[model samples]
Target: MVKIVALVGTNSENSTNRQLLQYMKAHFANQAELELLEINHLPLFDKPADKKVPEVVRQMALTIESADGVVISTPEYDHAIPAALLNALNWLSYGIYPFVDKPVMIIGASYGTLGSSRAQAHLRQVLDAPELKARIMPSSEFLLSHSLQAFDENNELIDQDMVAQLEGLFEDFLVFMQITSQLGHAHSVNQKLAESVSWENR
Candidate 1:
């Protein structure tokens, strides 16, 4: 089964982004092995304490490393990605660069008109690091300007079309991850073969 880690970037208990991500998780409940990683547990990054990392940070790194792919749901704050998300990324990048070359899909939600578009753009920039493999979804549309009001108290997605779009994005992301993983495995096999042949000839 495909292992997917759903990263929720909001700290609020009633975060719309979190709710949306949970909805996506439900869609893949039986089809894929899903794990949720919330950013609330992560402490602020500290360069000085590099040798003794917090347990939460250590766990976060392990999760990112083990997952076949990642799905991030975030909210825009001050026209950019939230500080919490940035902190989590900092932790992930410190040791092993867990996100490097890892398949990632990002989605954003907000109550403003922009629907976290600016934040998403900022996130894309951060993930543009040479080693990171960020997957850009073809259907890029904002779900906002009344997002909170549209959803019910239970956090269930009320709009049918919105639900359909999210489902399609997840489906496409799963396919993209599978193909890329196979390609990576193939590349690794070829490199090993080349090394073995060189050693044998020597």
Candidate 2:
């Protein structure tokens, strides 16, 4: 089954970003398996003590490594991505390099009128690490303003137009990920063949 890990960066139990992510997951239904990555459990990064990585951090990396793609749902905090999200990204920067060439998409939701626009922009910059290639959506795709009031407790989107737009965005993202996965598989097979040929020559 195709798997996509949805990362929610807020620790709040009633976070609107989490609700938005749940709505996105609903769009996939049986087409893809969705796993939610909780960022609250990760400890802060410290290079000196990096020899022993936290279990939560390691689990997060493994999840990202196994997934076909990632969808990050974040809320604005002082005009920037939440520290929890940044911390999670830092932990993933270890040897695993889970985000390397991974198909990733970012969505932000907030109660503010701009809907976490500043935070989204800041995140786009941080995700520009050499190991990661992020496919950030345009400003129009940012869900904000009445995000908290837009969805019910069940995480079902109440706005018809918003639901339609989100569906279209997810459809396009899935197609893009499929193409990328095909190319990655081909590359891996070619590399394995090259290794075998080298051993035969030896």
lDDT of 1: 0.73
Instruction: Give TM-scores for every candidate, taking all chains together and pairing residue i with residue i.
Output: 0.82, 0.83
Candidate 1, residues 1-202, lDDT tens digits: the string is 8998989988878888887777777767877777888998777877643356577787787888799888788899998888989888766655435675577888878887778888888888887653343444445544554568657777667887877877777788888787767666544443344234321222
Count clashing residue pairs per candidate.
0, 0
**In model 2, how large is the Cα lDDT of residue 169?**
78
lDDT at residue 66 of model 2 (Cα atoms): 87
Model 2 clash pairs?
Answer: none
Superposed model 2: Cα runs more than 4 Å off: 131-140, 183-202
lDDT scores for all predictions?
0.73, 0.72
